[model samples]
Target: MTVETIDLDAAGVRALNRRLQGRDGPVAGGHFIVTNAKGRHALAVGLTEAMDVRIRGHVGYYCAGMNREADVTVEGNAGTGVAENLMSGTVRVTGDTSQSAGASGRGGLLVIEGSASARCGITMKGIDIVVGGSIGHMSAFMAQAGRLVVCGDAGAYLGDSIYEAEIFVRGRVESLGADCVEKDMGERAADGLQTLLERAGVAADAREFRRYGSARQLYNFRVDNAAAY
Candidate 1:
């Protein structure tokens, strides 16, 4: 496949984005490699095609945000809100990510090969995130749907104030949040967990992981549950 290289240092971010979005010229949808990212924010944000993009270096805030039907891979570390609000397709980070990674994403998959900072996957609506390393404090807070898989330890208050989101941790969890509680992983659930691991190319035994979800006690504001809230 032919690869087009875009230099972020010279073309400027707007020109690069316009070319990727196929706005000022040929319609997008091809393989592209971005060079000299230099920790730029919003690299490849709001992509709405089926193109493939690979960023060769570290990226700053909100890289690949609001993505749809595209495959984006960051060859280096990512800053805050990586792949946030992803609508479809895949966004992968081969290195660590900053806070709020994949926040409020509605669909698709996010694979993080390294650890993530605070509030990873917060408020995720339907996205599936697989982290090869640990996640920081308050990860998955208020997540409404989808799943979060942490291959390493999870920091304090995992899934705090969560809502109907499935969480699986292969390592120790510092603490469970308000409505988050561990539950028995049935046969079907274990099978699904295996599938996620396979999709993320993570090698781990599904039986070794623990599953957690909302206890459903805080769904309504009852007077007795007021203190918990």
Candidate 2:
């Protein structure tokens, strides 16, 4: 493996990426480790190959955007939109993540070791998001289809405007969103959350979680209930 240690600077990181992009063959699949970094944003963006990128410190907004098949890991807290529009593979944050962590993601797995801010999985399509800590309000908002597992407290207005997505919360929820309600924790959900928690390395029982999801009330608009709008 060709190891490259990059400093946590915008220009230095950009130059490294440019150099990596120009490389051919197995060089693209080697390990790219970042050290002594601090709150840098968009550290790895638009990388198409399957590589392992490890960031040793805190990261700012959009740490990995439009990733195709790379596995990126962050050792510290991350800002908003940590893995936006991910296509495949996994992006794991070993610390807390901010709002819109996996917004509009299409595929892959996003594991957060700590709490996530509001809209944790907004508009998510097929990604499986597992949060070891609590999540903020409006989580799973307009989520078309995906699985979101929250091991801690969930904020208000959870799963608002959701569509065909499964949400499992292990802690108290302030409120449920429109067209969203709690369902009986079936064996499928239980098994699913167990797998997710195991993958995220969260030490929690899946049975302890309470499930919440769409009630299918607002799938279509109704003029008679316009007052509720």
Candidate 3:
């Protein structure tokens, strides 16, 4: 298949997004390459097609927010909220990302090859996130569902106020947040993690990681736990 190239400096983001979303006309599933993406915000937000898009440079906030069915890849670093609210498909970042990466994502796979800053995967509601490097403080705060796999160390307050979601960390965790506790990584869990790591193209042994999940302490509104509320 021929790869279509879109230059951000020449066409701009709005036009590029419109074409990718099929706003101009009927669009087919194909490969697209975006060049000269110099930290631009909202570069490819709200795309609903099943196209493969590769962004070649650093991008600003919300790089692929609300994406569905499209496979978006950022070859360089990403700013805050990368892949936020993604409903399906894959979003991969080859370099590091800033705060709130994959925040509120409902479904899909987010693969970050490098580290992520604070609040990565905050409020995630069923998306699978695999981070190859470390994550900063407050990662996965208020996560409702899905899985977060960190191949490297995690900073303070990991999985604070989590619910139902599972966190797998291969390296050290600085602290566990409210209602989050260490869970046993049984054989079944390890098997599942192995599949996820393969899907994310991460090379790591599932047995080397630890699992964490909600303690179910704050689920009921008991007056005794009012301080946590």
Best by TM-score: 3
Name the regions of candidate 3 deviating beyond 4 angstroms. 219-229
After superposition of all CA atoms, the RMSD between model 2 and the true structure is 3.5
lDDT string, candidate 1, 1-229, tens digits: 7899999999989988888777876635789999999999999988888999999999999999999999999999999999999999899999999999999999999999999999999999999999999999999999999999999999999998888889999999999989899999999989999998999889998999999998887856356766875
TM-score of model number 2: 0.89
Clashing pairs in 3: none
In candidate 3, what are the lDDT values of residues 92-211, reduced to their tens digit? 999999999999999999999999999999999999999999999999999999999999999999999998899999999999999999999999999999999999999999999999
Provide the TM-score for each candidate, comma-separated: 0.94, 0.89, 0.95
Candidate 1 yields a Cα-based lDDT of 0.93
Candidate 2 residues 1-229, lDDT tens each?
5777766664466765564453534545768888766787777776678888888999889988777788889999999998998877789999999999989989888999889999999999988899989999999999888889988899999999888888998889999888888999999889988887887778889999988777777836456676776
Displacement of the residue 61 alpha carbon in candidate 2, Å: 1.0
lDDT over C-alpha atoms for residue 83 of model 1 = 95
Order of the predicted models by TM-score, top scorer first: 3, 1, 2
